[model samples]
Target: MTSHRYAQWLRDSAFGSLPHPAISIAVTLGYLAALYPGTLPRDTTITAVLTTVFSALGACTGRVLARRSRGRPEEQARRIVFGSCLVILGSAVGMAVWWQNLIRSAVDVAPAGVGWCAAATLPAAVVVVAIVAVPRTAAVVAAGALALTAGLLAPADAGADEQRLPVSSSAQHDPGTLLRGELRVGEFDAAAADLARSWTASGGLSARAVVVAVPTGSGWVDSAAVDGFGSRFAGDVRVLTLPYDQVPSWQAFVSDRSGSAESAIAVVSAVATVLDSVPEHERPRVILYGQSLGAVGADAARVWLENEHPSLLDETVLVAPPAGTVALLSRTPRTVLANSSDPVVRWSFAELWRPHGATGDTHVRGPRVPDAPWLPVISFVQTSVDLLGALDGAAGVGHRYGPEQAGPPHPLRN
Candidate 1:
């Protein structure tokens, strides 16, 4: 009698844990929605994140509705859920073919077959189901175990200082008297003065053109842009970079941006002062170049130039500036390079309600999606999620820009 009672309790518990019919329907719809196309191709990791989030939301909502409606007969619930499953599965198969064709045509990528779709969605669904069906204590324990395993298995990166040491070294070894320096917090004036002195010491006052290449948050100046400058000026120009932060661009973008702004202001000011001392005929053309978060800093410097010294800057090149960041210095000769598929240049809350490509000033680049329709809130959500993999695409696509970023501000037609 005792063993039979124990077996009966186990069976009841298993049956009770089965998801309600509402949950099956909700999660299926949510998972299908996650499979919709976006600006970039969704890889397994991205798809998993989207699937898990949507499924969790659906599961919670379904559980609440089921509880409020009280219980239904088991046979009726089973029939409804089983019928819904067949319909959903059929829709998923059709959606998979359409999704594959859309991504292939739009991005020129190989097919993401139905297998890929299943691989991306199934594991995520299982994980979400485990969390939703398990008791709170068991769920917490599983999550903790997973985190610990990940921490143990994941590779560790070098320390921040170690990563930064190489930037200065690389700049020194690059061609054409490329000078790399750092900006000191609370010592902008002193740093600027020292930078001016360095320009004089390095014989840069004699160059016909000087390019101030502002680095992103991690002090990374694009080598292609530097080489482009050399090609543009016949190796007669001086390229100076004064980097500020040591953290990655995304971290600095979210945490503190004042460093890039302050450094840009100081370096440009210092370079301008030194150039002013030279004879007018001998003064080098001042060209400012920045990419990603660096563009934000360069924009700040442009504003400062407008107020303090109106005609100091000759031209500016900004690559992949964040969404909604406009060029305030309309008077200055400006070149903006943006890829239509670049999430960094298009991710914004405004996309939730309006069409993209509405900006008149931005020059959109190629490898663009041919048929990426902008659907109100869906586009916004997909774009926001795509930010995680913005840099994953090849050069000239998504957030990656090539040496063309260094092309002349105003090109002459052939």
Candidate 2:
């Protein structure tokens, strides 16, 4: 009887422990999937699916190990559940980190299809793991992480093509309006006609309005200068592209400059110049739009406008502004749109807080406007695909300072 009881105790304990290698390998592969879904061939989607199944099995095996090591049935169940939850949480964090890294890379690499694939699959995989494993605590954690990941990484498809404004036949009449130019900084340019088209399309606005887009990084291309604004605003809008390399004078102005900070100053200065040059009467209700590095540029410009030239800015929009800029700038009346799910923003906050003991709340100092009643529009695109798609499709364009959409416009104040 004594030997049998000892044997049972060993079995329960063994069942409660997880397989370290299995967890390690699954987590590593999951992260890789989050980073480069296209690295696996289309033929390999099945393989990827199978790998996830194996991961689930591995998790179960760990639970079994835990169950075996503990003798009491209730205790065994608790241990199994707890261990599974931890593993899932760890996997989720790993995936989020991987996704952020992938996005930063995709800004330079193309055939962006890979980035899209990764963005779509990472969250789905997390869901599958949660459902299949089904440990109560683990499932809850997996769900939360999945929600957060989807919110961050899934918006990629929405704005992938947002480099230029869409040009219809009407755009041809204005020769001066058809500015075909490009700016080069290091490896990136401020604007491209194709990107502008994508941007216009994403906003659901007619490509025939006065639109102004600012692409900040490396340098702004002529396309960014002319087409981005001219095509949308019908030559009424002036696109001011600020190339990072072209701003030596402004670069000297920022006291302790990081590359991002320099880019911000350059863009703000460029926008200020454009605003100054325009005959106030001809300037269409100016809307400032920025993405990624451009977001930092937009934020900086908004700050400058608020501090130095508040009269010049009519409306402003920033997508995925860097955490540093978000932290530094004061709240303004501009409409700021951000992705709650974006891993880049999240990770940036994590990096910031890890060193400085700050919270994500520190970066929340933007205008409170919601997506409607546009005087100072504040919109938060929920999904990556939707945000990117709106930017690409011209669905996200236009300047309406009133309520026209279905959802309650996110109020600017509160």
Candidate 3:
């Protein structure tokens, strides 16, 4: 077709509401794209959610491309569109098989069988059909599906004060006991006071250093980090964490990021108050720690500490901190532990155009996936997909940290 005619088609695709073969093919392509695997293997639930969400989004995208014009394509355009769709779909299918197998092999997981694939794609197909045949109903279904997904992904401990008893009663020998359970939604200060009082009663003030850990959105304190703290400090360190929310991390992140920060500030303030009661020469060092969504709170707490009581804050440790939210530098010593394979640490939109981890910060660790190449839009899509299974990877990879995550805080520079 001539350039003028091609421009006209483009306009029609962008504005017209006509049901074009190209639009349908595009929607199919989107569903197929969602089937391609990322850095980790996915379970059936993740597979269905990913496929359905992407399919619905793809339908909306297709609508935008073919929304305004009701004009039908020419015979030649129709033939060409069909031929192109075959080539594109065949390529996508081949890539889907290869990529899924590659990722599963890398993660040492069993390959998903054909039955699993069919079952996973069924929901996506249904959602796509609804979108094409009944747009309003499809919108409601998509919204509900997303809400259900958020709820399903939340941790078991999300939202309730039912605390998991410590493996041992001794907080020194079993720092995991320091979890202290969660408070209700708006009583972070009260929870902090209670936690501080509990720690003081347990002889926590005698430790060489006290680390206040910030739990993730689901009130999860990493068992690995707790164990590491106990082992590294040789029972001379106190670890304390305050739970802030019961929702999934992403939901909390979008709807109430400041709440996490407020929770951290409350805990830090409470800890600092207790430290003030001890003699200046005998006061224990204070180290702030957080991981993932916890890191968002830790970053905020670090800022509050820097401004309100700089002397009380000795060091900060952030593991797999979300890319955009973390403060890279600190007035006090700080360590940033990030795996190169972790999408949570490197999947910001800025990565679409520039390489990350190039900043001259001493704390930023290098990439673990040395051979992985960064492509413009492709990398973004790959990482976005990877976010779905980030926690499924083994320790020290993706979003999973090992016991080393609780290592001693960064030493101050001379």
Off by over 4 Å in 3: 1-21, 28-37, 43-77, 112-194, 246-251, 277-281, 341-343, 346-387, 408-414
Considering only N, C-alpha and C atoms within 3 Å, which residue pairs clash in candidate 3?
Answer: 13-65, 15-67, 15-68, 16-67, 16-68, 16-69, 17-67, 17-68, 17-69, 159-246
Model 3 Cα lDDT, one tens digit per residue, 1-414: 999998888766533333466566767667666665455566777677766776777778876776765776775675677577657755765666566666666556678787556656678767776777678887887688669878877543322223343422223234333646345568778778877887888777887778888878766778788777777677677788777776677677767887778889998999889888788778777888898889889979999999999888888888887777876577877777776567787778887787556223424333334334566665677677777667666776578777777743444531
Best by lDDT: 3
Ranking of candidates on TM-score, top first: 1, 3, 2
Highest TM-score scorer: 1
lDDT of 2 by residue, 182-264 (tens): 34344222333333443333331322223244443333332433444443444543343433433321132233224444444
Q: Lowest-lDDT window of 10 residues in candidate 3? A: 167-176
Q: By TM-score, how accurate is candidate 3?
A: 0.68
Write model 1 residue lDDT over 148-203, tens digit each, in one string.
75776453221121246343222243556577774465666565566567666777
Q: List residue ranges in candidate 2 displaced over 4 A.
A: 1-212, 216-232, 245-261, 267-286, 322-332, 339-414
Model 2 worst lDDT run, 10 consecutive residues: 398-407
- Which one wins by TM-score: 1 or 2? 1
